[model samples]
Target: MVRTRLINHPLVVGLLEIAAGEIGYEHRGMIRVLCDVEQFRQTIDLVVEGD
Candidate 1:
């Protein structure tokens, strides 16, 4: 904590911020990025299974 505070450089800060946000999502108060990896789906089968 003390070491990082001493190095108040923009580049370092930006990287550190990203790393922190990635791990500390709930506490940091930031928007989340949700993504869909696989587009293909068995829609009929999924619906039947759910029912």
Candidate 2:
């Protein structure tokens, strides 16, 4: 996926729409868990560095 300052770009909007539709709801939970794990890892790294 590409990020653009132009939120209304037709091609990017279309591509995101198609991608969103293709990702099933069943996989959302897994994605959320992965994101949570990433956040946790970052938090741990920050704590370690503070020592």
Candidate 3:
């Protein structure tokens, strides 16, 4: 996976934290986050999937 610099953005970091907390310990680092302006709805879905 090509880790993007966007990973450091506050919004991305906040989303990642929420995802990590929701998924819990076992699946901590297994999830992947992607962003696409053309697919706004789907991107939001991915962000909240852990919940």
Candidate 4:
């Protein structure tokens, strides 16, 4: 069975904060990004690559 994981790594959290800031919102302290394992891995790769 596929399971979901919560990603709270500092890099990922910082990225999310930056994104929320760029869009101009209070960031209310709640965020949800859903993706399968492969997509999640790809996202992390992109972030690591700074792309």
Worst 10 residues of 2 by lDDT: 28-37
**Residue 48 Cα positional deviation in candidate 2, in Å, after optimal superposition:** 42
Residue-wise C-alpha lDDT for candidate 1, range 3-44, written one tens digit per residue: 333335453445447656666645556432222323112322
Q: Give the per-residue lDDT of model 4 (tens digit) for 1-51.
A: 212232465546665576666654654655544445676576677555663
Q: Model 1, 13: alpha-carbon shift in Å? A: 0.1
Window of ten residues with lowest summed lDDT in model 1: 32-41
lDDT of 1 at 43: 27
**Residue 38 lDDT in model 2?**
57
Residues 1-51 of candidate 3: C-alpha lDDT, one tens digit per residue? 324654665556766677667665466445644444545454444545634
Candidate 3's C-alpha runs over 4 A off are 1-3, 28-30, 33-51
1 against 4, candidate with superior TM-score: 4
- Could you tally the backbone clashes for each prediction? 0, 0, 0, 0
Model 2 Cα shift for residue 33 (angstroms): 20
Per-residue lDDT tens digits of candidate 2, residues 1-51?
Answer: 212343345533443455466774455433222234455455445544554
Task: Tell me which of candidates 2 and 3 scores higher on TM-score.
Answer: 3
Supply the global lDDT for candidate 4.
0.54
Q: Which candidate model has the greater lDDT, 1 or 4?
A: 4
lDDT (CA) per prediction? 0.40, 0.44, 0.54, 0.54
